[model samples]
Target: MKDLFHKSLSRRSFLRYIAATMATTAVDWFKIEAMASTVEPKSDYPVVVIGAGIGGLVAATYLAKNGFPVTVIEQHDVPGGYVTSFERGEFKFDVAPHYTLGLSPFLEYLGIQEKVELVKPPEFFRVITPEHDLILPQEDPRGIIRVLSEKFPHEEQGIKSFMSLLNGLLQEWVKPFDMKTISSTHPIMWNLSKLNTAQVFDQHFKDPRLKAVLCIFGSGFGLPPSRLPALVFSPGTAASIYVGREYVKPCGQGFSNALMQAIENNRGRVILKTEVESILAKDGTVTGVRTTNGKTYTAKAVISNASAPATFEKMLSPGHVPDSYMAKLRTYRPSHSYFLVWLGLNKELRGKFKGFQNVVIPEHYDPEDDDKATSACNASKTRFQVYIYDALYSGYSKPGKSTVKILMQCGYRPWKHFEADYFAGKKEAYRKEKDRIAQILIERAESKVIPGLKSMIEVMDAATPLTHRRYTKNPEGAVLGYEHSMDNYWIYRNKNRTPIKGLYLASAWGSPGGGVNPVVRGGQSAFTDLMLDWAKIK
Candidate 1:
């Protein structure tokens, strides 16, 4: 039956089904291919990249390989922004990313597949609620449908239909559709992009618990189903279930280090611990960037992987930015950040939850209420996502030990009071608040997910939203850049190309939005845009 299902629902049939469902006229097969051929340097024009994040690193590596002299400036000591790791005792904990999908293709394209090792978990995630405890299988869309159907037999048809829709959408997305031509080329996606996740789920399902269970991925984006755009949710969830999710073996730092090494191998330079003070512009065109150390590097173009607010409001003079662009930027809201608690257990947890990388325990089944509680920083009411790194990878911790991390979507407003002091090294008050919040999360996890969780700790560390802001320099410490709301949908958001000439955005704050996969694509897109523009120079 599974073999028959695969044969019946071919790519052509999927497209046909999607076209009929959306009532679109036709599906155009015009794909935007990246210019992979190398070009000789016409002039000594170099490119300056701000931020050494994954996006910037990807862009710089490609540009340098294609005969462009590239230099990346990063404020942090390490290259990876949020995709980094820290050591506590003998254990290493990933800073942000738990597991990522769609990164293998990027690593393969960049010829760094062998440099990094990716491990896929047995399951995508385990969702736990008061009423249901479900496991979403990894790389098995049909299994997901079957599992959910068995759980809620009444909504079986709806489950199949929704999963099928998602499978079709994933196909369209992986085709690497041109963002500019997506509306006309893929009308189904364009239409879906206009609606929220909840609207799409409501159309197919009747059970609120089923919808809630399916909406687990929404928390990863820091938005509930009611606000997260269908375009983001549909393909993201599909990819995790179908294409499969993977984690960089050891930690995310290895992934970042590999990319940085690739860039250096291609003659790109990365300067760490240097902040880009301003993006120098003349005659409304970006000329170069000046570091906070009073050093200036002249380049023909600049790609900023920094936050949108920092790029426009802090890094550039007001006169350089058009009022209209600033207005649109102001209207867009950044996504919620997170407060995390990392604990190193003296005893191994592999015997308890085998092969489970992530386990989400939600206090309430309703995602809307979860979002509200999270935004309010009410730890008791919000959900807790626990990551058992040791369960997935054997070497994640010391012998007979485990590394666990618990986090939830937390708003920046609640941590605003500690921002100034936190960065100034006067963390007395900040530490008190963060510790208090961490205790709440720890206590909740101890009672709900892991019994005697507190007693197993050998090392403990915590980070607040303020810590996120300081490390990544993101506005409000947004985890996923701008919120994936209808107001800030991909079509409405700023693309890789900016209003100012020779300036581009190549980070989560830019087009294609956030997540490890999208940001890697964003980096490639920014590089493609810059290369295309440079081609027009002579």
Candidate 2:
């Protein structure tokens, strides 16, 4: 009966049609308010954007500035994906540490730098272990080198050479997809150092302690250096010292404020709390999106920042997607998700170690051996990238207080250890698990840094994979989108626009490969395609 109704009206029935057995009115209204359209007339935006993430918002803002009408749809109640913050009795905590590294260049390009304030935190990242407690100072390469030299006096050359090569690599490594040349000789430096993270640390350094420290660095992305593509090692590591020792939004620049204000400024409409059940397609082409609340959004093109797998696997008709596209999609692995621990302290964690981040590496960590263990879930030891980011905004927390967010990556099997009933219910079930994990993080934090951290916490919270998917719409709640190695980084990255016509992809999985810079870079690639359509009318 439902199929008959769907096929009978075809185009006219598109505005509203559904299964009577399902509760259409019970759809998530918060989602609709975030992504739905409010304009009464069937107005068409030159570019229709889906998922108002960092990439989508940056693209939408630019297109609108050029006098193009735009509409952005998101599945969450808020616009910013990982670039967000929440409040608890005058205390606010960030879900993701999105400040510092990529914010300046990316935001400045959009001319919206003034829109969000970026402040430089005292330290970037700290490393604490039984052997060494390293403080990564701001841009003091000699100081850094001296510190490492003392740790591994015999392996000083290895440390110095590694940093030199990594620096040279980062400066020459930024080859966006748009760059036509990718030859080994492109950087054309008087001195060239080509050592993938694994090669440099493993081949040259023999000390287990030194190898553990360097290899453990890859744990920043929840993967070992051996698993990370060699090319990214340069920019990836150098970014921390060279680019990372910089600035970030205080309470986190509120990526939504940046995008929403741009929408209002450009006169673009943003709707929220609505759900898009499916993309109506005809003869392998996108016709429009059918909101669960009976609203439809249509245009010449649709840009989906939602997870590619979710869209093709669940949202679109299987008949419409070609077999080859389906095959390639299957080959692409969804990256691992995170088990995050969010915290709000009664008073600011002050003193020397305060306002610092710690990437705690477990004792006896090895590079070559760690990746395999982590992948197989045989990791007896682990590491964490800690961000001691307190209130960036003036009022997010009362004066003299701060908040810290700690992120660690793990397999879904941990939380999914039991039946669905274990965590199957409203958002509250997830919240309870959050409390469970929050204790672990705080306990671990106290052991690493403070003697009594549990007492320091006035407020505590946690977010699970379910929470990640609920907000980001990421498949399986993957954080860095797709996990890649040297073998997968190149061809594995899909083109900005897929074979799906009038539908473009602009998310972490799309291009540039996750993080703030890559998301916007991927968005620009899709926008280039959008400009071609705009040129037609001009």
Q: Pick by TM-score: which candidate is best?
A: 1
For residues 1-538, could you state the per-residue lDDT of candidate 1 as single tens digits? 2231355455455444433322111222111123324345524768999999888988888787666789999999999888999888888888986577655555766789998899987687787777667787877777887788888999988888887677566546534467789887777787798789989999899988888788776668888888888887886676566556788897899999999998898888999999999999999999999999999999899999999899999999879999999998888899889889999999988767743644454645788888888888888888778888876766667789998898877998888887777778898988888888889889887766788998898999988788888788898888878887787666575688999999999888897788876677678778777767765664
Each model's C-alpha lDDT?
Answer: 0.79, 0.62
Worst 10 residues of 1 by lDDT: 23-32
Number of the predicted model whose lDDT against the real structure is largest: 1
Error of 1 at 104 (Å): 2.5
After best superposition, candidate 2 residue 63: deviation in angstroms?
Answer: 1.6
Candidate 1 runs further than 4 Å off: 1-5, 8-43, 174-187, 361-363
Cα RMSD to the true fold for all candidates: 4.4, 13.4
* Residue-level lDDT for 114 in candidate 2: 81
